[model samples]
Target: MPAPDLDLRLVRCFTTVAEHLHLGRAALALHTTQPALSRQISRLERQVGARLLDRSPRGTALTEAGRVFLPRALALLDSAAEAVAGARAVGRDRITVGYGVNLIVTPAVAELRRRHPGADVRARHVEWDRVRSSLLERRVDAVVARLPLDDDGLRVVVLREEPRALLVPTGHRLADRRSVTLDDVADEPMPRVPDERWNAFWRVDPRPGGGPAPDGPLVESAEDKAELVASGQAVAIVPGGEHLRRVRPGLVAVPLEGVEPSRVALATRAGERGPLVAEFRELAATHLVG
Candidate 1:
């Protein structure tokens, strides 16, 4: 016959009783009356369909079945305690915030630290290819990512709308132009993002004529893509965030015409209402403009 499905309460009672081998002492340890503990052990014995204890003048002794079950019962109770402890350890003041270099608002990150003094607030610079994966895989607790993300069990808070621009080397043909249209570089090769989640968005696919884009290097990080552009090997349409403009001075960003503005947002797993994630979302709300 199959073993009975015992609940945690029963397992805990059995472990306590087995530990002391005295009903009165075990009841005292468990803060229950002696009679109550006896009933609980009796119930457990009925469920298992085995005589677990031998009662005599000397007190209770484990029968063969009880001896065999004692070790497993203790193990179950120990595991439960550890699981509870592990869950509480999540409050150990550590959380990782992931973001693309361009999507992060510098001031907002500082504010998050100020708000969580005791928290080990850390940053994880995520690449465009891994934005959604990082959050889903628990690599980071929260993230600042671009829009057009699928609503697949995630929550997104719109922080700002960034104007899109094309990055070209200072010496490139379109570099000196005041501003250029997508058509001006229709056939120009741009770096490729092989990750399906990121490829279409970064590629700015469906050119003005609804056609495929010319391929360039298959890249991961924004820094790598910028290198390709700076070396005159490729061009990329990027968010015109102030930080990007300041860091990549070697590349001139010409505002692109007829392109959708990129929505920069804070994203986290759905149903995860942790305080760290909430605080970051609130901070983004006040500090960002979309």
Candidate 2:
């Protein structure tokens, strides 16, 4: 028999209920009553041929089947949203550029806008770890990323290079230093970022002594790393730029020595020969100064 078509509405309802784990709260969040929400869940369960949630007077809990289906359901929702956005962008002279933290791309964006008055240029903030994936997944047409990025299938233009610095708590020993070397921080715990290449580059993994830096708390965002540093739980290496001058109150960035300077680059897919992408890449090369 052919598979049944799944309703996105039902999937959304189930995910919300899974998140809250309570019918009452889920109903409120979905803006529907408990009984109606229960009906929706029942309809979904009937279509899927499995019970997704176990309901009790006290609360609700996911059945084994629900746990397996949740992630796929979320992906479906994400793809649906991306599909809608892509459709809307069709026939429009639009381009979205992604940029990482502490990196600036505004000057290039403004120049692109000035040159192509009819072009719809937009900037999206890309998390440090998502730089490559954002372009590969078509989330952004191009990105301004800090390098040591794995550029296997991408065209990369080196914009500039800048020294890196270590972010430490104000009272830490290294915080008082004019500068420090890899050996100085060899034993210090560094924030654990998701991407291996990124983690290796930022943490200066496999130190001069030849092993990975001591692992600290796992960090997913700049804010997370900053908080961990402020609390003295971990230290992070970042671009030594003007943005560091306004770092969080409890943290300071000390110059890091004995390492290669970080490079800022504009990257797009290898297959992208679009004029807008080409133009923006040229503008970034010209206007993005370190």
Candidate 3:
């Protein structure tokens, strides 16, 4: 026959009595009557085949067995409390996800809502670097970012890969090319975007020897960068994703010649949490494709 299980109620009853050294006081601590507490302790002692405490004229004192096992009982109580808190952390009325600094409002985000109508899906945009921190601190369960992140313990999935293009002014020499090489644009004027903002673009100094930096104007915001390219005053690098499909005639996109292209990936912490986190991961798998 299998041995009887260790009961939590017995641990609690023992701990209370151990601390108070009196049945009545321990019962009060547990919000139970003294007779009930006594019965619980008796059962615990019988299961262990040892007396936990000795009753004398003055009060109860810990027996040798109780002294030996008190620390383990205390550990059990602490573990129970922690287990409950961990479970509560994953439950929520609605799921909040970090959209990162990029767009998650595409068709896939819409589909997630349709699948989980009862769950409220709200979003907040943050810097790409902050995505992992947000997940670790519980600010958001998951985030969408350009993946292959350097986070020590995070998970990433390739969501989408769009062709990258060089955005040049209409009259620029490279603009006339059916396709242009990164070397052809080496001497062309370029503008700078915030390091944080341009992280998604695969345009990180693709030339050899850091050859002769272009003496170009610096521009903030992709819109201004696009405008600079359109005005023919400067050329900017751009990802030829759906976002760029709306380019006007003043701006022309030509593929980079002889250079390997790059793609974007979605990232999040590993392991399962709430339903929302799972849903977002699934959304990335379906929407983000190479």
Candidate 4:
């Protein structure tokens, strides 16, 4: 028998639903209605000939089949995205660079544009957590990333380092201090994020005495983290840069003492040494003064 012809759209819907595990949330993420998302998931389940998710009023859980299929589904989506990017890059002078929050790349981009008058150079704002993956998946040709990232297969050039600071609510005990050490906020709740390395580094986890930082609300974005701090729900350690000084109202950034500074760097896929990318990397190294 011939295999079932799967629709990539349905696969994408399944992956989005699987990611959030809530129809309404997944729909919001995908910019579709809940009923539409539900129908898409049902169509995918029928095509796959197995129920991938077990949904109830309380919550949603992945079925045995889902656990088995999730990785393959992710790989499929990644491959599709990469293929599209590759197709677009051929015979075109285009390069898209992604950057994390509060990091600037315009000087480098301007230089590159001046050097290659016909090249299409674009700058995109990427979320902190997605910086590394954005490059590996070919979502962007390069990225301006904060350091301590998993640079397994990328060429990273450290631009500079910035002192780290602790962000606390204005009325918090440490807010008025000239500078605070890890011990000052050791017992305070910190926002937890999905990236373990990122979470640990920013939280300064596993303190000198070897205990984990107190976990608070889960955050997925810089705004989320800043909001949590402003609301007095959690504290966060962020780069002590002028641009990042006043991220949210009711929050104050006090210089954090006794910790490694944050490194900012330009990163690109190791194998992509094309002229446009190379020139941009060199310009970034020289121009992006942290």
Candidate 5:
């Protein structure tokens, strides 16, 4: 028998539903009504020839088939995004560079346009965890990512270095300190990153004199981390960016002493530097350095 034709839209609907686990919440997230979302998922179940989710009186739960298909579904979505980006790349003079909220790439983006004139240079504000994958998946040609990025198979150019700061609740013990050392918060649990590689980076691993960090609740975004700080659950060591300072008033960032500053860089896939990507990266480097 021939394989089923999976619709990307249905897959997206399924994934969003899977993430929320509530039809109304998922519909609200997808900007659609619950009935509309239900129709889409029903269509998806027919296409897959299996019930992916089991709706129960208590709530919705994924069926065994869904547990198996979730990861593959996400991978397929990433592949579809890459395909769309690839199609857009062909016969076009455009490049998309994703950056975190902390690192401001606007100045670099403006300079790239000044240098390239007619070529399209766009910027995307990506979440912290999605930075590296954005580059790898071709969703963006390049990214302005923080330092200690794995250099195994990627090209990275350091743009600038900035001090790291500790974000704590306004009323926390260390909030009034002029500056803090890693030793001061050595015992305080820090927010966690799901990816081990990022877990260390955000946590500022290798404490003073090479100590292990105390673990805290999982955090995946600035807002999430801020909540942890405000709730006195955890603290965050982050790049000292003005944007970070302005996002949450409940949290206060004090400069972290006795540690190296964070490095911001322009990263691209190794040996895959098309002209537009190269030009944008060069402009970013020169502008930031100058």
Candidate 6:
């Protein structure tokens, strides 16, 4: 005949009794009275349809069935504990926030932490190209990115509409002209937006040459771009916030007269956000915008 279906509770009782080899001690180990243990053992025997213990003058000895079943019983309990623990670990949530150079130290990010205390916020300084990909794959919950995205799958919350500024060397011809127009430095070599963005539309490339064809200086991080301009190495165009002026004293930020400005917006995957992701978007809107 095939073996009977196993009962987890019975397995626990059998393992406890076999470990102690005595009813009273096994009862204490299991935190139960001796009579309850005896009844449990009786129930298990009826279920398994076998004698599991040999009662004698000395104490209890395991029957052949009990000796074979002990290891299997213990194994079942171990598996259950592991499964429960694994499930509990998945319950702790972690959300990823995507941004580039300047947003890392911005007040928006700072307020995000302040509003949501101890929220698991993982900030990744990803390029524009990877930001949407990360959002699509659920690698990140939301992204604070530049506006006019080519992709239409995600939704956005406009944070600010800031003016575009000219990044020029301090001693350059128009660097100290109060504020230079796009026509003023129309002939200088342009620097390209360093971060590799998914869509070219969101990129703020170098306008030093004043024309297409990115043959000029390639700048990556915003702070580094400012340093290059300050040193008179290469000039670039930047947004107002991206030019965190404290560190770059030599660079002059002049508002460009003609070129259209860029809008900074928060991007997130479409549909309803979970509690954690929703909270981040709310806090960003409250503190990031004017």
Q: Highest TM-score: give the candidate number.
A: 2
- Candidate 1 Cα deviation (angstroms), residue 265: 0.7
Residues 147-213 of candidate 6 have per-residue lDDT tens digits of 6664568888888887777777677787666677756654565655644441133233334453443
After superposition on all CA atoms, what RMSD does each candidate show versus the true structure? 12.7, 4.2, 14.8, 7.7, 6.7, 15.2
- Checking candidate 4 for backbone clashes, the offending pairs are none
* lDDT tens per residue, model 4, 1-290: 88877888999888888899998898999999998888888899999999998988997788999989889889988898888977888557899989888788888899888988888889999887777788877788889988778888888889898999999888998888989999888789998888789878888887778999888888898888888888889889999874245556688889988999988988899888677888787788789964
Predicted structure 3: lDDT: 0.69
Candidate with the greatest lDDT versus the true structure: 2
TM-score of each: 0.64, 0.79, 0.56, 0.74, 0.72, 0.56
Ranking by TM-score: 2, 4, 5, 1, 3, 6
lDDT of 6 at 228: 66
Q: Global lDDT for candidate 4?
A: 0.85
| Tens digit per residue, CA lDDT, model 1, 1-290 | 77588777977888787789888899999999988888888888888889888766688889999999889888887767766754664766667788876555566668888877887778888875566777766677788877767657788888778877889998899988888888889888999865664667767776657898787888877788889999889888888665346746678988877877888888888987678878777777887664
Error of 6 at 258 (Å): 1.7
Q: Which portions of model 5 show Cα errors greater than 4 Å?
A: 1-78, 241-247
lDDT of 2: 0.87
TM-score of predicted model 2? 0.79
Can you tell me which runs of candidate 4 are displaced by over 4 Å?
1-82, 242-244
58-170 per-residue lDDT for model 2 (tens digits): 78999999999899889999999987887786556889999988777999999999999988899999987777788877789899988878788899888888888889999
Model 2: lDDT of residue 232: 91
Comparing 5 and 6 by TM-score, which wins? 5
Where is the poorest 10-residue window by lDDT in model 1? 240-249
How much does candidate 6 score in TM-score?
A: 0.56
Candidate 4 residue-pair clash tally:
0
For every model shown, the clashing-pair count is: 1, 0, 5, 0, 0, 9
Error of 4 at 163 (Å): 0.4
